[model samples]
Target chain A: MDDRPGAPRQNASEEIEALITLMAKLPGLGPRSARRAVLHLVKKRALLMTPLADAMHNVAASARECLVCGNISGAEVCHICRNEKRATGEICVVEDVADLWAMERAQVFGGRYHVLGGTLSALDSIGPEDLRIPKLVQRVADEGVSEVILALGATVDGQTTAHYIADALEGTGARLTSLAQGVPIGGELDYLDDGTITAALRARRSF
Target chain B: MDDRPGAPRQNASEEIEALITLMAKLPGLGPRSARRAVLHLVKKRALLMTPLADAMHNVAASARECLVCGNISGAEVCHICRNEKRATGEICVVEDVADLWAMERAQVFGGRYHVLGGTLSALDSIGPEDLRIPKLVQRVADEGVSEVILALGATVDGQTTAHYIADALEGTGARLTSLAQGVPIGGELDYLDDGTITAALRARRSF
Candidate 1:
């Protein structure tokens, strides 16, 4: 006999539990959210879950990192790296694939991208060799890149990586620049942080 | 040349976009969260995404509704309905499969469940026939059920449904009861609504 007072005699099947565990590991999801997502998927299996499964299967089997730029793709090289029209002698550097995707969403930069994988972190024992900095320098030299845009974050590690990249590419003659810091569009001054306010003030322009 | 200022030369591949669209439609996910989940899945394809895909495929292919109850399962009758040890002479009625799952999570209810799918809503033109009421009545008469626990929400439609079920079961010997309304565990009094406080006060038991 089951000892628990109100507990169900049986729990969810092992397969379901395994799926929920894996889902909980996803970004922005915890155990509760994962359980909810799995239930929703199960309820809409025919309409949503089956198609999602197929898509995941396809991507999992085919997805690979671009050899030249490190962006994710179904081929040896990502589309952005292969696009001749985007070979505009400029390469935007970002920390991770998510940032690369974000830059793609903005649709502003017209050149290619080089994903650094992560910033140089001393605490984590990450160094220049751990990242794609050497490959970036090589790309700049081989591809005759005119500029390297460091679109890194304002965090300490981000700044450290940016400076390191600048020093690494000093002799390569490729002009290096970082994204300008300022108040975001539609941002309230009262809510703005001191660093942002100071940066906005320093980079202030005539209206 | 691409006309968009900062837009990527190309958007995500068709398969990826399809996956993102389906993911966005899930209960807790939106477009941005869906994108992040998809990217995380892509990055962890070997360890997480592949297994998740397989689990979903298996569940999608085999999952079905219990014939006796409306709970989701891999079998026709579901494990709970088939378990003879769980025949506790009680049926906890709920509005949806999610509610059933929640009750199961609590591990308090030891009886079977009858999912109503939805409440009787005059505003939405939903009547007793639209839900599993007739089936529930048939179950109570045929299955030797003694008690019917109404685990439905504390809404007007829920109360209306409970009363309607009671009326239907008047000839039968099944006793009907609803979940007690009260302030939830760890819930702040300041945050609780008037109705909850009143219910908690009215149902107060001696120490």
Candidate 2:
């Protein structure tokens, strides 16, 4: 059906269409935005498009999951995992590497991290074995970790995963804890939901 | 000034950061959305990231502007310009290749096109010489184009460019015309701007 009597029409060249289609696959970009991005890239072929293409190529060739923590890094083991000073006897467990990066951006935790990759989900048949849970358990025992902070989300699956990990490491003698749920800093009490208000009141401390 | 005493901390590896920075430069993608996109790309490295990178590289290497019409294509000339059946003695002028693609999508015009590259701008110091005005004149003369339709925007610069081209092609014997100024299809009169309403009223047609 190369050129039938009534073949489907194409808007632009196949190469441009292919670029737009792939651009649409990225997070937060739809078909319309992908088309706009493609046009913009074509307009700035040398300055933006070629450099972006090169960057994507380099990242694709080099980026790999850290063997120790599951965070995406340029090396087999990420910088945090390789840093001896970051081992601080604590490993913050997060559901995704994005969350790990978020924590790092805040510069709050000095210890290393263990990305769970995902929380337990019975509906999707995702279990502890499916994620980095086993590796987390092994790290706790081998590394003599003193504390395992569950910085996972407050969703039901997140809590279930946290509790499951706590039970899994019962004999490891590591102190297990989770992030507190409450009114966020700079949050208005009037805007908060009842659950948040209740949690903040229950976890309240002296002024 | 890397690793100096109290240097600024970085959240992710340099490669990942570079990818995010480049991604943020894309249209409709800000820093936050770019970070999310980079994370998604990293997670699907083999499936999506590699293919996208390859696509971009190929497009960047192969894509070129059509020598005659200024449309981006893999070949020296675009399919539209090369299609003998599309030589309908009419040339539709547009502001950009994106607009040319839009016209192709509509599939209303059955003739060739001329991409003006950009509109005339006095504030930005853009002149007729900066655009494809000379080339359009040569095309109108050499290609024996009978009707030159100006499909530029309603903006001041777009109108100014259209008028300039009209004056430039006065003795070329090509009938100079423009897209009708009216309320757009599916547009409400109440929601329309004053200038559009005035134009529509002045150029009103009989039922």
* DockQ of all predictions against the true structure, Cα-based: 0.53, 0.49
Q: Report the lDDT tens digits of candidate 2 across residue range A90-118.
A: 99999998899788777779999999989
What digit string (tens of lDDT, one per residue) describes model 1 on residues A33-151? 88889888888889888898898988888888899989888789888888898999999999998898788777788899999999999999999999999999999999999999999
TM-score of chain B of each: 0.92, 0.94
Model 1 DockQ, alpha carbons vs. true complex: 0.53
Q: For residue A80, what is the lDDT in candidate 1?
A: 89
CA lDDT, candidate 1, residue B104 = 83
Please give me the DockQ of candidate 2 compared with the native complex. 0.49
Residue A101's lDDT within candidate 1 is 78
Model 1 chain B worst lDDT run, 10 consecutive residues: B1-10
Q: What stretches of model 2 exceed 4 Å from their correct place? A: A1-7, A185-194, B1-7, B183-207
